[model samples]
Target: MFKNRYLYIFLHIIMWLGYTALPVLNAIQRDTSKPQTNPYTNPYYWAYVSFSSILLFYLHSEYLFPKVYKQKPIRYFILLILVIAILLVGRYSARINFVGNDINQTLFYINSFIQYLYIFGISASYSFFTDYQKQQSTKRDNEHERLKSELSFLRSQISPHFMFNLLNSLVALNRKKSNLVEPVLLKMSDLLRYMLYEKDDKQISLDNEVKYLQNYIDLQKLRFGDYVDIDFNVKVPTFSKNIEPMLLIPFVENAFKHGVGMIEKPIIRVELQTIENQLLFIVTNKFSNDVQEIKDGASGIGLTNVKRRLELLYPEQHSLKVQQKDNFYTTELKLNLRQVA
Candidate 1:
C-alpha cells in the first residue's frame, strides 16, 4: 500500500515536469517563425500556474463571495469587472509573452479560467470526502464501544455463575460435616469480594489478579487434594500493570471442572509471566480420551465469553490459542499491556 503511494507521487511529478518542459522544448527545437501546433511554450508551467490560481479562486469564493452576494446586482457587476481586469493583465504580462506571442495572453486567460473551475470542483470534492471520513470514523468508534459494553455484561454474568457453583460445593461439604469447608468458604468470600468490587473497573493491578488466582487455586486444592496434581507458577513483579477483570478465571475453572473432576489421575499445569509490555498465560490439563463418557459435549460458556472479551478488549493487541488432542487440553493467552496503559 505504501509503495503504491510513492509510485503515484513519482509518476505525478514526472508528468507535471514533462508538461511544463514540453512546450519550451518543442518551441526551441522547431521553427519559431511558423505557427506552432501548441502555442504554449511550457505546458508544465501552465499546469502549476493554473493549479495555484484555481486554488486561490476557490478560497476567495468560500470566504469573499458570501459578502459580495449580500448586495445582489452590484456585486454581480463587480465580479464581471474583476474578470476583465484579469484578462487585461494577462494580455501584457511578459511571462505569458515568452510562452506564445499574443496568443500566449489568450492561453493564459483560458488556463486561468480552467484553473479556477478546477479549484471550485476540487474544493467541493474535498469537503465531501472529509465529511465522509468523519462519519466512517464515528461508526467504527460506536461499534467498539458496543463491543466493550457486551463484554462487560458477559463478565458480570460469569462472576455470578462461578460464585453460585462454588457456594453449592461448600453447602454439600458443610452438610457432610467436613472440617475443610469453612476455610475454603472464607477464602471464596474474599475472592468474590475482589471480583465484585475491585474488578468493576476497566483494569486491575496484575498483583491483585495473581493473588486472587492463587487463593482460588488453594481453595481448589482443599477440595480435590491428592487426586489432582495442580502446579501453578506465577513470578510476581515488583511493579504491576492493569488487566481486564475475571478474564483468566474461566479457563482455570474449566480446567478443574471438566479436566480434573472427570479424570481419576488428573494433572493441571498453569504458568504465567509478564515482561515489559506483554503478558503470557499458559494452562494445560490432562483429560480422559473416552468420547462417550465425556458428558454433554462440554460447550463452555466461560470459555466462549472470555474469548469474546479478549477480542473486543484487545483486538490485534492480543493472541489466544486453544488446542485439544486425545488426552490433553491446552490454552495460551498473550496480551499487549501497552494498549491498556
Candidate 2:
C-alpha cells in the first residue's frame, strides 16, 4: 500500500511537470530564428520549476485534500476565489519579469502561479475521486447488510414452516389412531434432531441433506396418498460432498402448498442432479386457478427473502428462475458446487 502511494504521488508530479512544460518548453524549443540565449539553459529555471512542483504537491496532500471535510461550502468557496485571484496576479508579475529579462523574478512569479493552479485543480480532482470512492464503498456495505438481514429473516421463517407442517401431520395422525403414527412420529423426531443440531451449520454433507429430504417427502406422502403424487428423481455421484442444508426444501414446500393443496389430482415433480462442480434442481407443480390466495409467511415475508439468500450465498455462481404460465408454477435453480467442496 505504501509503495502504491509513492507511485501515485510520483505519477501526479510527473503529470504536472508535463502539463507545465507543454507551452513554455515548446515556445523555447521552437523559436529557432532567435539568437542563442542563456535563459533557456539557465539552472535557475529548473530550480524554480522543481520548487513550484514540490510546494503544490505538499499543499494538495497536506492541506487541501485533508481539509475538504472540515471546510463549509461558503468558506471553501471564498478560499478558492482568493487563491484564483492570487494566481492571476502572480502570473502577471512573472510575465513582466520575463519581459524585463530578470530570470529570478520571472521564475518566482510565473512558477508560483502555475504551481498554484496545478495544485488547486489536482486537489479538486483528487477530492472528487475520493468522494466517488466513498459513495461506492457505502453502497456496497448497505447491500451486504441488506443481504445479511434478508438471510436471517428467511432462515427464521424456514424453521417454523418446517415445524408447523410436521406438527400438523402428527396431530392428524393422533386424531385418527392410525398404525403409521409410530413410524411417522419417529421420522418426525429424527428430522427435528437434524433441524435442531445439524442445521446450525452453514453447510452439511450432501448425503445427509438428501436423507433429510427423503424423510420429509415420506412424511408428506403418508398424509396425502392417492390424491397427491410426488416424483423425486436425484442423480448424484456416491462421493463425500457438502451442501447448504435445507436450501432446497422451500421450493419443495412451495410445490406442496400450491400444487396439491386445492387441486383435485395434483402432481409434484422434483429432480436433483449433480455433475462435476454443479448442482441442478427443477421443481414443477400443478395448480389450478381455484387454489386459495397465496399466504405470506409468519412475519409478512415471502420468497423474496429466499432469492436474497441465494444472491448472498451463491452470488455469480448460481442461477434461479421462476416461471408461471396457465396453472403451473416451476422453479429452476443451478448452483456451482465447487466452492462448498
Enumerate clash totals for all models, in the order shown: 4, 0
Clash count in backbone of candidate 1:
4
Task: Using lDDT, give the best candidate's number.
Answer: 2
Assess candidate 2 and give its lDDT.
Answer: 0.72
lDDT of 1 by residue, 226-335 (tens): 87899999864643677887788888988877776557689999889887878999999988876344344334777888888887778898998999986889999998
The lDDT per prediction is 0.71, 0.72
Off by over 4 Å in 2: 1-52, 65-70, 77-107, 177-179, 197-208, 222-228, 238-244, 261-266, 285-304, 311-330
Q: What is the lDDT for 308 in model 1?
A: 86
Error in Å for residue 228 of model 2: 4.3
Model 2 lDDT, residue 20, Cα: 58
Model 1, residue pairs in steric clash: 19-44, 20-44, 23-41, 24-41
Give, for candidate 1, the lowest lDDT window spanning 10 residues.
290-299
| Residue 259 in model 1: lDDT | 73
